[model samples]
Target: MGESGAGPGTVRPGGRTARVRAAVLQAAGDLLAERGFDGLDLAEVARRAEVGRTTVYRRWGNPSALAADLLSDMADQSLPRTETGSLDGDLLANARLVQRTLADPRQGRLFCALIAAAECDERTAGALHRFYRTRIAEWAPCVEQAEERGEVPPGTDHAEVVRAVSAPLYYRFLVSGDPVDVPAADRAARAAAAAARAGAFTR
Candidate 1:
């Protein structure tokens, strides 16, 4: 059976079309969390969302597109970067955000499911790459600011520095199966900041 409150009888206090889209996306996220990408069925999503199956089919066409759309929405809704006036502080903020997200039950599972889907679907992979690109871009300015302040050498690769801040956390989250905690987040931030200072990311 479909989830309660997502079914047709629920009233949403918004434009009908917007409500329908939100309901559909919410249903899709729930199913993705519950069953992974292989289990994402548009018909089921539509039924759960109280939206017509035909609308789902006509709009998304396939599960990959649906998953891609979800990723796009997630990227759009993600928090903006923190400006802490120091490389270490800003990078720590970034790492902590990544750690918190990976440590979240629903969000962790959703990310794992999306990554698995990307492995088997080119379009999904592209969407996933774009999502990361957007996130990295959002935080890259912190490193650029660090460079301007002479905390890091001139010509440091700002994006790489941003990527470094999250790499270890993601490695633990996606590869090592280790705990992602505040200490780990701090370590990742410190390591990235140290590397940037040492000119490891110089262009």
Candidate 2:
């Protein structure tokens, strides 16, 4: 299998290789969601994926590497940002998207597992950071557009603005354990928009 030029854990192969990768990642995600990182066993994952243990061990080597690959796959599959023609509208869209994902049963548990795994594993932590960076870059253009429209200061940090919109939602998801509903999402979006307009994210 030829490795993708993008980065680690981003191999893009065809035919049997691709099928094996897909099955492995799917099994890994299920296991992570079910038992977090501690319960992620390469042999069990191989069984769940219905693939050879040798194949799983040779391809990923360890649970952390498998987690990294799963995160890479997630980054590759994440949805594109919504363009709504206004800063508030765009930010609202972003906030709602985050809220929905973090509020979903399976997805929410999966993310919690990933975050917990990242806390203890350096490789998983790096992969998690890279995943968020990729997501932030994907949505940062909305803030840049707002700046171009004179909605915010010229030096406003676009990525920071985008992060602000998600910070509160994530806080609820990972810390406060509050429900991430529509109201919370809307509040986060408005707060971020207000902060941006107030030059709070200025570089």
Candidate 3:
């Protein structure tokens, strides 16, 4: 909904364009994490990225657009889902990945800022939703594989199972202010795996 109708940061540029995008997105992320959405100045971003101010304006136009594009870039750069043989193992792997990310100081702050931005900006919210959807889609296959192996009942909602694994971690990260640690991740994975096996996510 911001900038181009095709979606922010959807273009796959090459050569200098690719490098410019990489730099601009990096600068945007740093600014968002540091000064937040309210302070994300396109001119500052251009300066930090060493790109022309006109280019940043022409490409992104506004702070929300820049934030959306950064999110899109992050989604594109996220690691592929892990393939453990069992649902339990896969969920644990997924939980650990999320835990590690949220527990990281820089990444944690970056996410907090992005989530805060989403609360007030529709463009950022759409990008945030797309980011989660992409990540969920990446991990949902684990639940499908588990269904094939009879680890869970048939007709399980794969996306919900994957979402269940990350929900608790995010709750702690964004709300409860509890420690986002390995043990918390382990608990989340076990709980989600149990719930899925109990047919709680049946379609």
Candidate with maximal lDDT? 2
Residues 1-203, model 2: lDDT tens digits: 00112222233678889889988888888888889899999999999989999999999999999999999888887878889999999999999888888887767788889899899999999999998999899899999999999999999999999999989988988899899899999999999999999999998
Give the Cα error of residue 185 in candidate 1, in Å.
0.9
TM-score of every candidate: 0.91, 0.93, 0.93
Q: Which has the higher lDDT value, candidate number 2 or candidate number 3?
A: 2
Candidate 3, 88-110: lDDT as tens digits: 99999999989888887667778
The 10 consecutive residues of candidate 2 with the worst lDDT sum are: 1-10
After aligning candidate 3 to the native by TM-score, how far in Å is the CA of 196 from where it should be? 0.9
Q: Which stretches of candidate 2 lie over 4 Å from their true place?
A: 1-13
Clashing pairs in 2: none
lDDT of each: 0.84, 0.86, 0.85
Return the lDDT, model 2, position 24: 88
Q: How many backbone collisions does model 2 have? A: 0
- Mark the regions of model 1 whose C-alpha exceeds 4 Å error after superposition: 1-14
**What count of clashes does model 1 give?**
0
Candidate 2 residue 150 C-alpha distance from true site, Å: 1.1
